[model samples]
Target: MAKCTAVIDIGSNSMRMAVFQKTSRFSFHILHEVKSSVRLSEHAYKNDGYLQSATMNRTAQAIGEFLSIARSFGARKLLCVATSALRDAPNAQEFISRIQREHNLSIKVIDGEKEAYLGAIACANLLPKMDALTVDVGGGSSEFAVLRNGKVETLYSLNIGTVRIKELFFDRNDLAGAVAYIDNALSALPDFGIDTFIGIGGTFRALTRALMKKENYPLKKLHAYTTDDVRFQTFAEQILQAGPKKLKSLYIKTDRFDTIKPGTLILQRILKYTCAQKLVCSGVGVREGVFLNDLLRNSAASFPANYNPSVRYLLDTYATHSDHGIQCSHLVKRLFDLLQAPLNLKADYRHDLVIAAKLLPIGIGIRYYAYQRHSHNIAMSGLDYALSHTQIVLISHLLLFKKGSRSSSLIPRAGYGTLLPDNATVDALSAILWLSHILLAARINADTLSVHYIDGKLEIRGKHLYLAKEQLRNIVLPKNLIVVFQE
Candidate 1:
């Protein structure tokens, strides 16, 4: 039986409910998600730091609606976690009681330490393998986690947040003071080793989307999107100088004007503090964290280190089984190993080529004609949890090449080709996949199929096979590689 769970995370700035369907023992995919900008922290920190009765009532209603929608998905398990705003309110118990008494729901208000750890769990598992200083910046507080070697070495939940900063520091023209506040508040944080800043929460996502628009980024996917400090600073300056009207002109949602600039300003401080050059925006945060925690409850693993790819899990859940993918994967690797000598391709491509081969048949399972093209789209935008943005593009291109990807339109130009390595990189890898594909489709069984540098001419010594017009296209390799097949 398929087990599904919903995690409803009530944060200071927004309320989110994510439904995660367990696709495998260790991995799950988002079945459904709904978020509301309830801004539970609105005025909750004023004076005595009590959740205004009206604010609590409104957020409670949002929670009830989210729970109802979650129930519709047949979610057998529901976990609700509230952070920051609720934790700070002196009358938090009163609000919690109201949730239980009115909606018969139990809300676990976790502490700052747990909140930071959960954010780490979501990031370490979903993003690529990289050491980063991760920050889950919320409306009420920001959680900093130092991720090194797939583990969070240090974490802190500071009271510095977008909403808090806006309230206390936005009106002050002294930008230096705001940064000084951040530095002072986070004085206890240890010296950071990694330079990559993994920015989470809605504000960072909003900033990322806005930057994507400014730069006309092509991928259109938000997770794992990276931007350099210079580009982001340009937007940050505009956001800082612009009012709500100007932000709208820049394509930033007007609703975010009240907080986006402040958030970006805080981000600037974080960058300076860590001297990080890159900001990897993660769409996953505390809500996804809660769902992952529950999903891995009984498992021995506590992190993303050994988790199965969410792509593999989703394919399994959809019952898209393909033994051909497995076969192609093996055949492609063998060809790469045998051909790399004369091809002069790097060993780094082997893993990517294998992934490309394994995921090829998934598109055919969807439709037969131009299935490779469909596979290309899925690989670029659909698969999740493991491969980096670079890997995704390479795999997508390999899939395209596997099906004779040669035309100008067929080139999978992600990051406008700049993000992709030089043509020689994919060219050689694609050549290998293309040849392996032909042999697999033709069922050409050869006792000896190998590449040999014979008399300075690449020779194919395989079973004297007839090459068709299009078959020759498969043999076209990178300008640098010279190879002859022999069987």
Candidate 2:
């Protein structure tokens, strides 16, 4: 049975609800998601640190709709959080009281420190292995978390955001003013280890959109977006000079265009000050963090022996289909190992090849006409957690090769950036995964088959390999590759 949990995040600029259905040990499928731009912080300055009546009413209506959806989905638990604007508002208690009385929902206004900590937890669990500085930019504030070896080292929240910055320095067209404001805000905080910065929230999303347009990125996945200093600076300058009217022309979303410039400026300032080479865009944020924290607490209390929700979910999802995937992966690896000496490929190439082998059969549900294409589409579209963009592209390309398709034309060019693999490596890995899939289809229990080099020839040995007579007619082995089946 699938257990569902709903998390509603009320931000200064928008309100979002994410419903996660527990599928397996560490796997949760996103059941439903809804976002509405309420702009609660629009009048924070005018109202002198209080939420305005109009914004509060709209927010209440949105939350009511979100609650209905959550109940319909049969969510076991619901977590509602208000950040930045609501937390800072002088009349926040009044707003909370009204929400409880009218909607029967209690709103927890979390402090900036807790917000930053939760964001870090989500990133740590999502990526698992990375030295990341998680940054969440909201309407009224921005949370920065420095993580080392998947553990939070330090965190800080600043009074800087798309809406907050716009309110403070929107009138000042001078680039120096924006830079100074950003520098001053960041300088006060204790030093955070400078490494790869993981950007979250609206500003980061807008920056990614601008980069995607500039590069003509074909893939819509936001999992692994890496931008160098030069590219970041170039886009920042363009946004600064063109203003909102010109930004709209570039197809930037209307709701975000007005704030994008300010947001970009903030990102650029942080990057320049930190002297980081690249920015990684993370789709996960405060809402995910909130849900994750709740799960962790529950897991600790209820199942002390089996703690860690993320790991549990991952194990459960993989248990269903991992055996076949691992079998194919082993065969693919053995084949690649045998050919590695001859192909002279680097060590990193093996990772891409193995991932391709695992994901090849994932598209069996779709029609076989272009099932490889469908598999490739699913991989490039982004996985639920942690898998990077480059990893997805490589896996997608490998799947494409299984169908004897040209990966260059099918895979998107822009999302890869500088990490794009060499053509020779791509070709070799594709061939290896395709052959493994072909061999596996013939014998479901063919786990003993091993690929090894015998006098410069690739040979497959095992009882199943010897018994499979259809290999001669159905299988098309790569040229110059000799396959010897041993009885």
Candidate 3:
């Protein structure tokens, strides 16, 4: 595989180019990106599947510009794929041939099923592992991939995207007929006892952004942001009632207001059709899927099945030192074994404990004072895609108190009634992490210390206890746990 590969995704609404820099197998990030809203479906669908000349010329121009940008970024290879609008266009081969002849760019026009598969590839590897209906609402069509047990069980593509729906249904005065048509198209979709909807593509992202803005959400990241069915229903209704003149006020993109409402209607029906209760938005789509598939084609390239993508991204981006974090994680695992029964904690928390241990000190690099709160902010905002929102909140709380700093004024206040568990579990987890920090801060050899739970009292048997005895005494712990220091 090339060190840097450029992926150009020609969709119905927009043509986008993403340059990915591969740091390692299954590890990469977008180095550069560019997009142009060509809206090929706007003309092609209205003109009997014949791609309009002006639209094709505009697409050719965008492709030429994107290719230039990619080359300027030192891209070593290129993978260009065109979706629905091009696939359904009668003269798509002519357009592809013209680009090839004029600019030496070979564009692969993928079928609906292949497009759905590529979209699923991205969702399976990058998003949280779950049973979901991954819906990619493009401009010319919508691709649905039903993921069961993290595998694609069914794939379907409907010729009803934002642009297509707007062209077909926006002018219809018979509201009942429009809904009936939508329902008839959606009736073919089957529900697999799955209530989670994973929404991909630009329309869903715009909705997530607007919803986040409305709530004054602190985190700006989009992946794995979930919205309840009630919120979505309200928004969908608002979009349905909003005219193009009023759409700009709804926080949708100015260019997208014309079609966003139609998109929302399509998504609302999809939610009902699939009996899904919640929608998790993903910023990734067919472009990322294409890149990942092309990358893994090389025999030496692969990603770990259990590795958390967002976790690695956060650690690589912000962490100053990983040795301490790794050592603390090891120490916490050891304590979970020794303290689980006494603390009344279950093994379910072990996964969160490990993640919190590694991420607890990331904020120290920003500043030492109030570093735990900083770490909390980083985890809440940066670490995502693998854990549930509840797990994320719990992990943030665990990291907040990891350094033994339990101030009443600290962040993540106790007002979230049921968001947190009973205080005992939090205290125990905090104390265990705090103890791990102190034990290692004493410069004791990581391998020399062993924990023993004796008669409900905690003791750390180590080779050099005398050297750090005074520092250990200064640290605070959960008052419930009887701690013993023995040399």
Candidate 4:
């Protein structure tokens, strides 16, 4: 595989390109992303599913520019796929041939089933595992993939879409006709008794973003944001009934006004059909799936056991003193084992704690001074894949608090209290980390330090005790916990 690979998705409504750079065999990060509103199916749906000349020209130009950007980033492999627009069009070969001749780019026109599979695999590998139906509502068609226990079970695509419905029924101002058309298409799908829905593509993302803002969500990350079905259904109903002025007030962008209603209706009806109880918004789609499919072709399209792409990427690119980081991680784990019972920390938290400790010194690669802030910001933004928003926020906060800090004050004061465990839990975790930092501050070998907890007091015995003992005074211990250092 190329060190840097580019994946392009030419949809009915948008043309997007993402460039991913590999850090290790199975670790990678997105380097650049570009999106253009080409709207390739603009007049095609109304004109008997024939590719229009004007939209084709615009799409060609965008693809050409995307290729230039990809080449600028030294991308050696390019995988470009076209979805409903090209597959439904009668004259798609004309646009494909033109792109091939002019820009030397080959566009693979994928069927609806393959398209749904791509989107499903992306969510399966990138987001937290779940058993649900993945809904991808595009401009020309809507695709569904059934995922069970981190595996894709089935896939289906419907002829109903935002642009298709808009041209066929909504343009005629026939609301009942639109609903009937959607229901007719949906009737072919069998119920799977799945109560959760994973929404993909731009329409779902836009709606979820608006919901996030209206509810004053603290976390800015959108990938794993979750909401109950009742709230989402109400919001979708309001969108269907909202006028142009009302949509603007609801935070719907002006660019999406024309097709938002159709997309919302498609999504709302599907949610009803599936009897969805929860909605998990997906920020990844076919493009990411394409990359992952190629990146993990040998590994059965799944990451190695116990491996996280985002964490590996962080360690690969940012970790300066990896030996120390590894040592620190071991020390923290040992400390966690000794204090887990007394501190009452959950066993599941150990994974996150180890990762945070291993990457704590990554900020030093950027600069030596005030590196903790850098580490905090990097963790908040870069730990995006395969983890929930709460875990991400908690790990970032754990990296932020060092010696002489109280987790209760720092977390709530920094607006992340809602995303963390209770104050006592956080303080215990923070205290363990702080104590580890103090023990290793003198760059002593981790083997030189030993820790044990008995009753309510914690004892540490190590060589070069002066620095550890001195820094211990400036730090705050967990409530009712005592630390005694010995040489």
The candidate that wins on lDDT is: 4
Q: Note the clash tally of each candidate.
A: 12, 9, 0, 0
Give the C-alpha miss distance for residue 218 in model 4, angstroms: 1.2
Model 2: lDDT equals: 0.73
Descending-TM-score candidate ranking? 4, 1, 3, 2
Output the number of the TM-score-best candidate: 4
Instruction: Quantify all predictions' global Cα lDDT against the true fold.
Output: 0.75, 0.73, 0.78, 0.88
Residue 184 shift from truth in candidate 3, angstroms: 2.4
Candidate 2 error regions (>4 Å): 171-179, 191-193, 296-323, 368-370, 382-384, 401-420, 466-469, 472-480
Whichever of 2 and 4 has more TM-score, that candidate is: 4
lDDT score of residue 434 within candidate 3: 66
Give per-model TM-scores: 0.89, 0.87, 0.89, 0.95
Q: State how far residue 158 of model 3 sits from its true place (Å).
A: 1.3
Give the per-residue lDDT digits (tens) of candidate 3, residues 313-390.
666666756567778888888988888888789788888888888887788877888887888888887666667666
- Ten residues in a row with the worst lDDT in model 4? 407-416
The residue ranges of model 4 lying beyond 4 angstroms of the native Cα positions read 412-414, 444-448, 461-466
